[model samples]
Target: MKRTVLPFVLLLAAACGPRYGMRVPDKLVEKLPYESRIELLESENDLALAIDTVDEASNEVLRARDAIRRAKARESAAEEEENRAADTASREVAKLAIEEARARVTYLRAKQRLNVGLRDVEQLALRCAFARYELARLQSTRKAKVEGSEKLDVKKYEGQVSQCEAKVKEERAELAEDSAQEKTAREAWEVKKAALAKKTFDARASPYVENL
Candidate 1:
């Protein structure tokens, strides 16, 4: 039993000795060199990624600023275009207003002239009616006085009455025509005046704020 125990203890001591011999000394070994290199490489890689992120963010900011500038420029251009359009519209409206006013004045003048002519025709018709009535009364009295006494004179007077009647008829027709023409002229003037007045009101109330 003693011999067996001694041999086993010697074998255990030999195994422990070889195991201790396989380990390197602390002073001779490169301590944690691979781990330290990996750590430094990882830190440099992180810095490169951070720089790339910053560059991308700066590019985005520049793009946004450029877009904002373009938007403002477009807005300014649109405003200028609107103002130009308004100015053009104002000029056109003024020209139209002037033309309409001239037309209205001309129509009014024509209406006044027609009215004066109509009054003259009416007075002429009145004079013609009075003359025809007096001629008719003279013919009736001459016929009652004598049938054969100066028959030629009676025929002459009858012819004069017929001529006077024709004249009165012509005067009445002319007066009716003149009255109709006067009414048409008056209606035309009123229409033009109304249209011009409405246009003036619209111009005053418009957003452009310019008189036409």
Candidate 2:
């Protein structure tokens, strides 16, 4: 709980790639009574934010689709790499079969390389938990002077802590899921490889037996 800075989530968000600015003109707010105008403005802001989010997500999807198409259309496209494993709705179904892992090419590539270890996952989870603890400690402290100055909002701090806890839960879930998937994949691969080796050995020894 005695951390020196904000949680890594906030820092990571700050360090991530640039995002398109979503500017909604203030002129969209209607002229009305104080309370009614405030309500209208808030609603307009929420709608604008939602619209921006959808637009960004749509653009991302389009970019991903286009990239896949380009990869498929390339002259040097490998046979298995260019397979249209799934369009969109069939991705979940495609995962059940392992022949052409077009959608999971990145995962396969990472599996072939050095990847994050369990210790990293545990460290991140611990840091997030500590961040939540620190937030709770701050909220529980008797420092009302900061609140009196209109700088500290108890509700806001509580919300931040809640978000941190949710993140901790999410990290744990993802870690568990990834670990299970890795174990399953390795087990299946081992079974297949052992069978293939046995068949190969038998084939090589078959001609010798016939000659004898």
Against the true structure, whose lDDT is highest?
A: 1
TM-score of each: 0.33, 0.30
Model 2 vs. true fold: TM: 0.30
Question: What lDDT score belongs to each candidate, Candidate 1 first?
Answer: 0.42, 0.38
RMSD score of candidate 2 (Å)? 17.6
Error of 2 at 63 (Å): 29
Candidate 1 scores a C-alpha RMSD against the true structure in Å of 60.5
Summarize candidate 2's per-residue lDDT along 1-212 as a digit string, tens digits.
11322243334334422321111112322222344344333333433343344445455445545544543333123343235644542332223223222323333322322134333434444434433433433333323222222334446545654665576577656666566665565555444334333433434243111110
| Ten-residue region with minimum lDDT total, candidate 1 | 20-29
